[model samples]
Target: MKIIQKHELNSLKRSVDQGTEEQREAVKKIIHDVKQRGDAAVQSYTKQFDRVDLEELRVSEDEMDAAYESIDGEFIEILQEAEQNIRRFHERQRTNSWFEPAADGSILGQKITAIDAAGIYVPGGTAAYPSSVFMNVIPAQVAGVERIVMTTPPGKDGNVPEGVLVAAKLLGVHEVYKVGGAQAIAALAYGTESLQPVDKITGPGNVFVALAKREVFGDVDIDMIAGPSEIAVLADDSAKANEVAADLLSQAEHDARSSSVLVTTSRELAEKVEEQIETQLKDLPRYEIARASIDDYGAIIICEEMDEAIAVINEIAAEHLEIMTKDPFGDMAKVKHAGAIFLGPYSSEPVGDYFAGPNHVLPTSGTARFSSPLSVDDFTKKSSIISYSEQALKSNGGKISQFARLEGLEAHARAIETRKERWK
Candidate 1:
C-alpha cells in the first residue's frame, strides 16, 4: 500500500465505471428484446450468457425445498437469527402516515405507503450473496411491501445457488426467477409472460445490470448505481495494525477496483499495516483481486492530528468507514460523511455486511457525501396530505389564486377560485 500525506485525500474519489458503449448497446438490445418478446428473450439470454436452458423461469416449491435440504440445520438457524436482527433494525425505520389538525380545522401532513411491488437482483456465479438477500429483502418486508420478488442467474446445472434460494425462502420471497443480467432487469421493469413488473428494483449486479437499471429507471425506481466496495479506516496509535489490515482486505477482496484505505495519525501504525497487508494477501483466496485493488486503489494517508484524519475521512466519504481510534465514538462525532460507520475493531465492515442489523446495501463511490444507505424508505413512497376545511379554504383561496397567477398558471388559479366562487 502506498502512504501519502493528507493533501492526497482528493485522489481517492474514484471515477465510477459507466461501462463501454458496446456493453451499453448490448444491454439496451437485451432490454429491448426482453420488453418486446418477454419470456423468450429472457430464456435466450440465459442460454447465451449463463449457458443454461430453463424450462421454467420461476423457482418451484420442490427446488426451494431441495435448497433447504442442501443447507445444514445450523446455518438455517443462523439465517433465521440474522433475519430477526435485520427485521428489528428496519422496523425502527418504518414511518407512519400522519395528519396535523390546525385552528381552521384544516388537516395537513404526510401519508406513507409501501410500493405495490419490489424486485431485488442477487448476483450468482462466483458471488452468491445470501447476505444481500437478507439485507435487501428484510427492509422491504418490514416496510410492508406486498409483492417482493428476486432474480438470480442459474448455473450450468440449471439451478440457482442453494444458499440464495434458502435465503429468499426464509423471507417468503417465493417469486424468484432464474434469469440474470440485463434480461432479468428487463423482466422486472417490464412484465414478462411469467414475472409481473415491479414498482421498484434494488440490489447490486455487474456493469450490464447497472446499465439496465439506468435505462429502466424512469419506468421503475431503482436502489442505486453502486460502484465497487470501499473501506476507509480512521485509526490512531491505539489501533492494532494486523486487525486493521484484515479489515482493509475485506473490501479489497470484493473486486479488482475496490478501494481499501487507512487514514491514521500514527505513521508507525501506517508502516505496520502496510507490512501486515502484504503478509495477509498471501493467504487470501481472492489474492489476485485483492492485490490489484490494494496496489492500484488502496492507500494509507498520514494525518498530523485526529481532526485532520477525521477531515480526510469526510472528504473521501467512503462506503464503509471504520473508526479504530482510542475514542471511536468521539471521532465519529467529528466525521460528517460515510455510508456506514463501524466503531472499534469488533465492528468490522463485514459484520455490517452480514449479521449486523444495519443494511449493507449502502451508498458506494463517495455517494455517501450526499446519499444514504438502503432503508425502508427506499421501498416506501410518501404523499403529502392536505384536507382544507370550508373556513380554511375561504381564507386561503384568494392567496392561493394570487400565488398561482404569479406563476401564470391560469387553470390552477381558476381551480381554486371556482371553489371559492361556489362558497360565495
Candidate 2:
C-alpha cells in the first residue's frame, strides 16, 4: 500500500472518484439491447453471460418451497435474526403525511405516499448474497410499497440460488425473475410482456447494472449508482492492527477495484497492519481479489496529528468509515462526510452490512458526499400542501397582482386583478 503525508494529499474533490469509461460504454450497450429486444434479448444476455438457458424466466412457488426446505435450519434462524434487526432499524424510518389547520380556515401540510411498485435487483451468477435481499426488500416493505418485484440471474443449471430464494420469500418479495445485468434493469424500467414495470428499482449489481440504472433513471426512480465497496479506517495507536486488517479485508474481498485505506498518525500501527494483512491474505479464500484491491486502491497515510487524520477521512468520504481511535465519537463529530460511520473496534462494517440496523447498500467511489444509503424515504415521496381561503386571497390580491405584473405575466396579473375587483 502507498503511504502519504496528510498535507501532501490532494483536495477532497480528487479523493472520491468513479470507474472507467470503457466499462460504462459496455454497460450502455447492454441497456440498449435490452430496451430494444425485451425478454428475448434478456434471454440472449443470460445465455451469453450467465450460461443459463431457461424455458421460463420466473421463479415458481414450488421452487421457493424447495429453496426454503433445502437451506439448513441454523442458517434460516440466522436469516430471521438478521431480518428482525433490519426490520427494526427501517421501521423507525417510516413516516406519515400530516395537515395543519389555520385559524383563518386555511389548511396546509405535506402528504407522504409510498410508491405503487418497487423492483429489487439481486446479483446472481458468481455468488449468492442473502443479506442483500434482506437489506433491499425490508425497507420497501416498511415503506408500504404495494408490490415488490425482484430480478436475479439464474445459475447455469437454470435455477435461482436456494439461499436467495429463501431470503426473498422471507421478506415477501412478490415476484422473482431469472434476469440479470442491464436487461433486468431495462425490464424493470420498461416492463416486458411478462414483468410489470415498477415505480422504483433498488439494490446493487455489477458495472452493467449500475450504468443501466443511471440510463433508466428518468423513466423510473432508482437507488444510487453504487460503485465498488470501500472502507476507510481512522485508527490510532490504540487500535489493534490485526483487527483493523481483518475489517479492511472484509470490504476488499468484494471486488478487485474496491478500496481499503487506513488513515492513522501511528507509523508503528500502519507497519503492523501491513504485516498482518500479508499474513492473513494467505489464509483467505478470496485472497487474490482482496490482494489486488489493497495493492491497487489501498493507502496508509501518516497524518501530523488526529485532526489531520480526520481531514483525510473527510477527503475520501469512504462508504464505510471505522473510527478506531481512543475517541471515536469525538472524531465522528468532526466527520462531515461518509456514507456510514462505524465507531470503535466493536462496530465493524459487516455489522451494518448484515446484522446491524443501518443499510449496507451505501454510496461508493466518493459519492457519499452527495448520495445517501437506501431507506424508506427512497420509496416514498412528499408533496407540499397549500390552501388559501377567500378572505386570505382577498387580503393578498393587490400584492399578488403587482408581483405578477412586475414579472411581465399579464394573464397572471389579470387573474389576480379580476379576483380583487370581485371582492371590491
Candidate 3:
C-alpha cells in the first residue's frame, strides 16, 4: 500500500456515479432485449455470460434435495447457526403499523406493509457465497415479504452450486432461477413467462449488475447501487501491526478495486503495518488481486491526533470502519459516516460480514454518507394514514384554504372550502 498524507484523500474517493459508455450501452441493450423478448432474451444472455445452456430456468425440488444430500452435516449446521443469528437480529428491526388518535377526532399514523415479492441477485462464477444468501434473504423474510425469489448464474455445467441451493432451501426460497447479469435484473423488473416480477430487488453484483440496478431503479425498488468493498482501520500505538495488516488484506482480496486504508496517529506503527502487508501478501492465495488493489487504491495515512484520524474517516465515509485504538467505543462516538463500525481488534470486519447479525450488504463508495445497510426496512413500505372528523375539518379548513390560496392552488383551496361548507 502507498503511504500518503491526509490531503491526498480526495483522490481516493471512488466515483460511484461514473461508468464507461460501452458498459452502459451493453447493459441498456441487454435490458431492452429482455424487456422486449422476455424469457428468450434472458436465456440468450445467460448462455452468453455464463456459457451455460439450460432447458429449465427454475431449480426444481429434486435438484434442491440433491443439493442437500451433496453437502455435509457440519457446513449445514454452520449455515443454520448463521441463519438464526441473522433472523434474530433482523426480527428486532421489524416494525408494526401504528395509529395515534387525538382528542379532536384525528387519527394519524404510518401503516407498514412488506412488499408482496422481493428478488435478490446473487453472483456466480469464481466464488460461491452461501453467506450472501443468508444475509439478503433473511431480512426480507423478517419483513414478512410474501414471495422471495433469488437469481444466480449457473455454472458451465448448468447447475447452481450445492451450497447456494442449500442456503436458499434453508431460507424457504424455492423460487431459484438460473439467470444472471443485466438480463436477469430486467427479468426481475419486468415479468417474463417463466419468472414473475418482484416488487423490490436487493444484493450486490459486478459493474454490469450495479448498472442494471441503476437502470431499473424506478420500475422496481432496489437496494443502493453498491460499489467495490472497502475497509478503513483507525489504529493507534496500541494496535498490533500484523492484525491490522491482516484485516486490511481481508477486504483488499475482495476485488482489484477494493480500497483498504489505515489511518493512525503512530507513524512507527504505520511503517510496521506497511511492512507486515508486504510480508503477508506473499502467502495470500489471491495475492495478485490483492496486490493490484493495494497498489492502486490502498493507503496509509499518518494523522497527528485521534481527532484528526476520526475526521479523515468521516470524510472518507468508508463502507466498513474498524477502530483498533485503546478506546474504540469512545472513538466510535465521534464517527458519523461509516456504513458499519467494527470496534476493537477482536471485532474484525469479517464477523459482521458472515457470522455476526448485522446485514453484510452495506452502502459503498461514500454512500455511507447518506444511505445505510440493507435491512428489513428495505423490503417494506410505509403509507401515511390521515383521518379528520367534521369538527376538526371545520376548525382547520379555513386556515388550510387560505394557505392553499396563497400558493395559487385554487383546486386545493376549493377542496378544503367544500369540506368546510358541508361541516357548517
Candidate 4:
C-alpha cells in the first residue's frame, strides 16, 4: 500500500466518482432495448453476456427444494441465525400509521404503509451473496411488503447457487428469476410477461448494474447507486496492528477497485499495520485482487495528530469506518460522515457484512456524505393525514380565507367561505 502525508485531497475524487459517460450510455441502451423488446431482449443479453442458455427465466419451487437438499444443514442453520438477527433489528424500525386528535376536532398525523412489492438483485457471475438476500429481504418483510421478488443469473449449467436458493426459501421470496446484470434491473424496473415489476429495488451489483439503477431511478426506486466497497480504519497507539491489517484486507479482497485506508497518529502502528498486510496477503485466496486494490486505491496516511486524521476521514466518508483508538466512543462523536461506523477491534466490517444486525448494502465511494445505510424505512411511504370538524373550521375559517385571497387563489378562498355559512 502507498504511504502518503496529510496533504493529498486533490487526487481523491478520481478514486471514488461514479462511472464514465460511455459506461453509463451502454447501460442506458440495455435498458432501452429491454423496455422495447421485453423478455426476448433480456434473454439475448443473458446469453451473450453470461453465456448461459435457459428454457425458463424464473427459478421454480423445485429448484429451491433441490437447493435445500444440496446445501448442508449447518450452513442453512447459520443463514437462519443471520435472518433472526436481521429480523429482530428491523422489527424495531416498524412503525404504526398514527393520527392525533385535538379537543377542537382537528386531526393530524402520518399514514405509514409499505410499498406493494420490492425487487432484490443478487450478483451471480463470480460470487453468490446469499447473505445479501437475507439482508435485503428481511427488512422489506419486516416492513410488511407483500411481494418480494428476487433476481439472480443462473450458472452456465442453468442452475442458481444452492446457497442463494436456500436463502430465498428461508425468507419466502415471492418469486426468483434467473436473470442478472443490467437487464435484470431493466426487467425489474419495467415488467415483462414472466416477471412482474416492483415498487422499489435494493441490492449491490457491478458498475453496469449501478448505472442501470441510475438510469431507471424515476421509473422505480433503487436503494443507492453503489460504488466499489471501501473501508477506512482510524487506529491509534491502543489498536493491535495485526487486527487492523486483517480488517483492511477483508474489504480489499472484495474487488480490484475496492479501497482500504489506514489513518493513524502513531507512525509505529501505521508501519506495523502495513507490514502485517503484506505478510497476511500471501495466505489469502483472493490475494491477487486484494494486492492490486491495495496498490492502486489503498493508502496509509500518517498524521501528526488525531484531529488531522479525523478531518481526512470526514473528507473521504468511506462506506465502512472503524475506530480502534483508546476511546473509540469519544473519537466517534467527532465523526460527521460514514455509512456505518464500527467501534473497537472486534467490530470488523465483515461482522456487519454477515451476522451483524445492520444492513451491508451501504452507500459506497463518498456517497456516505449524503446517503444512508439501507433500512426498513426504504420500503415504506408516509402520507400526511389531516381532518377538521365544523366547529374547528368555523373558528379558523376566516384566517384561511384571508390567506387564500392574499395569495390570489379565489377558488381556495371561496371553498372556505362556502363552508363557513353552515357554522354561521
Candidate 5:
C-alpha cells in the first residue's frame, strides 16, 4: 500500500460510472438478443458464460427441499436469525399511504404502493453469499412486493448452490432461475417466455451485469450501478493496527479492483498497520487478488490532524467507513459521506455485511455522497394524490389557470377553466 500525505490524495481517484466501450457493446448485444429471442437467448448465454447447459430455468419445489436438507442445521438457524434481524430493521422502513385534507374538502396526499414484481440477481461465480440473498430479498419482501424473482449463475453441474437456494426458500422467494450475467438482467427487463418481467432489478454482478443494468434502467427501475467494493478506515493513535489491517483486507479480498484505504493522524500507527497488512496477506486464501488490490488501489494516508483526516474521508466518500478513534461515535458526527459507517473496533465492516440488520448493498465509487443503501423504499413507488372540491376549485382554479397559461400550456389552463365553469 502506498503511504502519502493529504496533498497526494487527489491522484487516487476512481470512477464508478466509466465503463469500457467493449463492455457496453457486449452488454448491448446480449440485451438485444434477449429482447428478440427471449428464453432461447437466455439459455445460450447461460451456457456460454456459466459453462452450464440448463434444461430447466426455474428451481423446482423438490430441488428446494433437497437444498434445505443439504445444508447443516446450525447454518440454517443462523440464516433464520439473520433473517429476523433484517426483517425487523426493514419493517421499520415500510411506508403507508397518507392524506391531508383541508376545510374546503380538498385532499392532497401520497399513495405508496409496492411494485408488482422485483428481480434480484445474485452473483454465483467464485463465491456463494447467502448473506447477499438475505440482504437483497428481505427489503423487497418488507415493502410488500407481490412477487420476487431471483436469478443466479449455475455451476458447471447446472445446480444452484445449496446455500443460495436455501436462503431464497427460507425468505419465501420461489422464482429462482438458473441464469446470470447480462442475460438474466435482459430477461428480467424484457421478460423471457418462462420468466415474467419485473418492475425493478437489484443485486450486484460483474461489469457486464452492471452495464446491462445501466442499459435497461429506463425500461425498468434499478437500484443503482454498483462498482467495486471499497472500505476506508479512519483511525487515530488509540486504534489497533492489526484490527484495522484485517478490516481493510476484508474488502481488498473482494476483487483486484476493490479499494482499501487507511487515513490516520499518527504516522506510527499507519506504518504498523502497513506491516500488519503484509503479514496478514500471506495467509489469505485470496492472496493474489488482495495483494493486487492493495498494490494498485490501497493507500495509507497520513493526515496532520483529525479534521484533516475527516476531510479526506468526505472527499473519498467510500462505500464503507470505519472509525477506530477513541470516541468513534463522537468522530462520526464530522463524517458527511459514507454508505455505511462502522464504529469502534468491534463494529467491523463484516458485521453490517452479514448479520447486523443493515443492508449490505451500499453505494460504491464515491456515490455515497448522493446515493443511499438499498432499502424498502427501492422496491416501492409513490404517487401524488390530488382532488379539488367544488368550493376549492372556485377559490383556486383561476390562479391555477393563470399559472398554466404562464407556462403556455393552453390545454392545462383550459382543464382548470372547465372545472371553474362547473362551479359557476
Candidate 6:
C-alpha cells in the first residue's frame, strides 16, 4: 500500500466509464441482431461467448430441485436465514398507495405500484454468486413485482452454478434463462420466442454487460453501472492492524481493479497495516489479483487529525466504509458520503455483503454522493394522483390557466379553461 499525505486525495477519485466506440458499436449490433432473429440470435451468441450450446433457454423446475438437493444442509440453512432477514428488511420498505382528500372533495396523492416483471443478469464467467441472487430477487419480490426473470451464462458443461440455482429455487424465481453478456440484456429488454421481456433489469456484470445496460436503458430500466468493488477503512490507533488489513483484502480479492484504502490519524497504525496487507496477501487464493489491486489502486493516507481523516473519507465516497475508531458512531456522524458504513471492528463489510439484510447492490465509485443502493423503491414506480371537485376547480382554475399561459403553453391554458364551460 502506498502511504501518502492527505494532499494527494485527487489520485483517489476515478472517472466513470463511458465505454469505447468499438464496444458501443458491438453492443448495438448485438441488440439489433437479437431483435431481428429473437431466440436464434441469443442461442448463437450464447454458443459464441459462453462456449455452450443451449437447446433451451429456460431452466426447468426439476433442474432447480436437483440444484437444491445438491447443496449441503448447513449451507441451505444459512441461505434460508439470510433470505428471511433480507425479506424482513425489505418488506419494511413497502409503501402503500395513499390519497389525502380535502374538505372540497379534492384528492392529491401518490400511487405506488410494482412493475409487471424484472430481469436479473448475474455474471457467470468466474465464480458463482449466490449472494447476487439473494440481493436482487428478494427486493423485487418484496416490491410486489408479479414476475421475476433471471439470465446467466451457462458454463461449458451447460450448467449454471448449483448455489445460484439453489438460491433462486428458495426464492421461487423459476423464470431463469441460460444467457449472458449483451445478448442476455437484449433478450430481457425485448422478448424472444422463449423468454418474455421484463420492465426493469437489475444486477452486475462485465464491461460488456454495463455497456449493454446503457444501450438498452430507454427500452428497460437498469440498475447502476457498478464499478469494481472498493473499501475504505477509517481507523484510530485502537484498531487492530491485522483486522483492518483483512477487511480491505476482502474487497481487493474481488477484482484486479478493486481498491482498498485506509485513512488514519496514527502513523504507527498506518505502517503496521501496510505490513499486514503484504503478509496476508500471500495466503489469499486470488493472491495475484489482490496483489495487483493493492499495488496499483490501494493506498493509505496519514492524517494528523480526525477532521482531516473524515474529510478524506467523504472525498473518496467509497462503496464500503468501515469505521474502526474508538468512537465509531461519533466519527460516522460527520461522514457525508458512503454507500454503506460498517461500524466497529465486529461489523465487517462481508457481514453486510452476504448475511445481513441490507442490499449489497450499492453505488460504486463516487456515486454515493448522489445515488443510493438497490432497494424496494428501485423495483417499483409511483404515479401522482389528482382529482379536483367542481368547487375546488372553480377556486384554482384561473390561477392554473394563468400559470399554463405563463409557460407559453396556450393549448394547456385552453385545456384548463375548457372545463369552465360546465360552470357557466
Clashing pairs in 1: none
Candidate 4, residue 310: the lDDT equals 97
User: What are the per-residue Cα lDDT tens digits for candidate 6 across 1-424?
Assistant: 9997677767766666667999989999999999999999999999998888889988999899999998999999999999999888999989899999999999999999999999999889779999999999999999999999999889999999999999999999999998999999999999899998999989999888899998899999998898999999999999999999999999999988888999999999999999999999998999999999998889999988999999999999999999999999999999999999999989999999998899999999889999998999999999999998999989988999999999999998888889989978
For candidate 2, write residues 346-372 as lDDT tens digits. 998888888988988888777888888
Can you give the TM-score per candidate against the true fold? 0.98, 0.94, 0.98, 0.96, 0.98, 0.98
Residue pairs in collision within model 4:
none
TM-score pick, better of 2 and 4: 4
Against the true structure, candidate 6 has what lDDT? 0.92
Query: How far is each candidate from the true structure, as Cα RMSD in Å?
Result: 1.1, 2.1, 1.0, 1.6, 1.1, 1.1
Q: Candidate 2 regions off by >4 Å?
A: 7-33, 421-424
Residue 357: error of model 4 in Å? 1.1
Backbone clash pairs for candidate 5 read none
Show the lowest summed lDDT stretch of 10 residues, model 1: 8-17
lDDT of 4 by residue, 150-249 (tens): 9998888888999999999998884999999999999999998888899898998888888888888998998987778889999899999899999999
Q: For model 5, what is the error of residue 383's alpha carbon versus the real structure, in angstroms, after optimal superposition?
A: 0.8
Can you tell me which runs of candidate 1 are displaced by over 4 Å?
none
| Global lDDT scores for all candidate models | 0.92, 0.86, 0.93, 0.89, 0.93, 0.92
